[model samples]
Target: MEATLSVIGGRWKGVVLFHLLKGKKRFGELRRHLPNCTQRMLTLQLRELEEDGLVKRTVFPEIPPRVEYELTPFGRSVEPILVGMRDWGEKYKARL
Candidate 1:
């Protein structure tokens, strides 16, 4: 659907969600996973995901502060779709 696509349509969004599937991660961890994505772009994509109710961002109060990202229950609903995409990609890769 158009609405659904809009939320996860960007190049980095789906990738971001994919990494979050494993569990919560810090900003640095996400950057390590998506090395090509600029810090600014990653920040923007994460903000959008948070707004869409697919991702949750938490900030801890402490020296240097800690932040983490994890998928919300609503976001977990997309697990099947991501898994399907991964399966399809593998098949397509083999064909090519």
Candidate 2:
């Protein structure tokens, strides 16, 4: 649907969401997961996801400070779709 696409569509957004599906991740961890994505691209995609209300960002006040990203319940609603896509992609690759 156009609505879904508008929120999740993009070169890096889906990938970022996929990683977040595993659990909360710090920014550095996400960067490690998506090494090919430029930091700027990832930051932009995360900002959009946050603005869309599908992702949550938490900032902890500490000596060094901490930040983490996790999916909102609304975001988790897409898990089945994302999981299906992942499964299909695996099968398709195997068939190649």
Candidate 3:
């Protein structure tokens, strides 16, 4: 659990993964979705996830250039864990 938290606990990290679960997104698209996060922070988080083998980053050469991010197979493995936490949080909130 400690290790898991270390990888996912940074501010906005979990939120980044949560939104990526929906589908692949460009850097600008992710920025728009995560409006509260600064560009530098988002870039760092994505690099960490990539290093962890949980996220894939693809670059395309073009006039404007393009980059996309998506979850890897290992990253998809984390979905159930996130869902479980969500369920537990909802139940706990009800008790409050």
Candidate 4:
């Protein structure tokens, strides 16, 4: 469990959570932001977040189809942590 938390603690998970803070987003939208990430990896991360009860995915019926992901209250609780990480990252970069 500790290892799993660490796995989803940073990297694309934080990025994904940051975007979700704005509201819901589709898979493609997430892809646009994290251009270097592969579809398979993104899918896996999203599934993990969902399993951890941090994200909620909704699907809609349409011609092209629609799927959206948003944060749950549990996930929203991590906003301050994300902000602190962003601040720390900027400070670390400035020092380097």
State the displacement of the C-alpha of residue 63, model 2, in Å, after optimal TM-score superposition.
3.5
State the TM-score for model 2: 0.92
List model 3 lDDT by residue over 60-93, tens digit each: 9986989999999998888987778778889999
What is the per-residue lDDT of model 1 for residues 40-71, given as tens digits with 9 covering 90 to 100? 99999999999999999999998899999999
Q: Rank the candidates by TM-score, best first.
A: 1, 2, 4, 3
C-alpha RMSD of each candidate structure in angstroms: 0.7, 1.1, 1.6, 2.0
lDDT string for model 4 (1-96, tens) is 576457457579988988899999999999999999999989999998999888999999998999999999998987887787789999999999
Computed on alpha carbons, the lDDT of every model, listed in order, comes to 0.95, 0.92, 0.91, 0.89
RMSD of 3: 1.6
* Greater-lDDT candidate between 1 and 4: 1
Our tally of clashes for model 3 stands at: 0
Off by over 4 Å in 4: 1-4
Cα error, candidate 2, residue 12 (Å): 1.5
Better of 1 and 3 by TM-score: 1
Top lDDT model? 1
Measured against the true structure, the TM-scores of the candidates, in listed sequence, are: 0.96, 0.92, 0.88, 0.89
Model 1 per-residue lDDT at 50: 100
